[model samples]
Target: MSQNNAIYKGFKVSAKVRQAPDAFPGGDVVHPRFLATVTITQVSTGMGSQRLLPPEIQQFADAPHAAITLALTSAREAIDGMSTFVKAK
Candidate 1:
């Protein structure tokens, strides 16, 4: 997926999509399934940040672009939430 990289609240958000077999058999015709992964890292330190979201299984989609969009949205929301917590302290 293109435009998979984003910067949010001083952190870098990188998104990638991977193909995975469907848990349940798809009788007759099988369709491709994709999982989107989002990685957040500190731009200043280049260190990996903790995942604010849950497992990739919850972010799966039938279409690659939809999966990527979901990943990007989740990543940005996580960054925003983290920043808000830091400022609260």
Candidate 2:
């Protein structure tokens, strides 16, 4: 697993890359797939954290860096208010 963090539009965007689970129940991962996750947190006081993307194995990238990039982009959209992610309680 790899993690990266950045501050964007007063929101803290944290992203991480994780390897997807094996396709078969007891088989090796023939082609490893990397999945990414993004968590967006409000930097201001009295704000809560929000998960921009779920860490599902169904969505993956060919490379770890690519996965991280994908996660960050999604977080950026949410932080920019372009996404429908819930802002506050």
Candidate 3:
């Protein structure tokens, strides 16, 4: 992690979900995939922004909103745990 006067703008988390439309009589439901992304940027340039990605989750819930919430929660945890800094190159 590099503290290059980026001014710790903020962070964000997003998730994508999918549902199968076809089933033969009865089929095991496919779980949605939850992804969490944390972005840190500077207020000035917004360039060189860093993105923190958590391991792709198997599922958060049966719906998109729930999955998003869960992903965000995970992001929060990750953010809370961030404390490292990079030396100037």
Candidate 4:
């Protein structure tokens, strides 16, 4: 989306899995790690468009990266929890 239409802007975080040397001897190598990348982008009209529009439109700009990261984490956790719950059922 374009900047004008963006309600907020923040970074984009991601997770990466790769092989790395284990600090201990004769230990299982490799592990998964989440790497957060600070990518500045405009929050689309879909995030909180309704509440952020009209009277609150003027306040939209350079949103905090931490807030976006937390939201992403929460969403991921919710999805994971749902998957686990479904699998158990």
Worst 10 residues of 4 by lDDT: 52-61
Cα lDDT tens digits for candidate 4, 1-89: 21111122232223222222333376655443222222223234334332211111011113334333544454344333432222222
Clash number for every model? Answer: 0, 0, 1, 1
After superposing candidate 1 on the true structure, give the runs of residues whose Cα lies further than 4 Å from its correct spot.
1-3, 25-30, 45-58, 85-89
Task: Report model 4's TM-score to 2 decimal places.
Answer: 0.25
lDDT of 2 by residue, 1-89 (tens): 88888888766778778897747587755687888878776674324544343332223688889988887887675556545455454
lDDT at residue 29 of model 4 (Cα atoms): 52
Clashing pairs in 4: 8-43
TM-score of each: 0.65, 0.65, 0.41, 0.25
In model 3, which runs have C-alpha deviations exceeding 4 angstroms?
1-9, 20-27, 30-59, 84-89
Compared with the true structure, what per-residue lDDT tens digits does model 3 show for residues 25-64?
4775555433322333223323454545445433345555
Local accuracy by lDDT, each model:
0.68, 0.68, 0.43, 0.29
Tell me, by TM-score, which candidate is best: 2
lDDT of model 1 at residue 63? 88
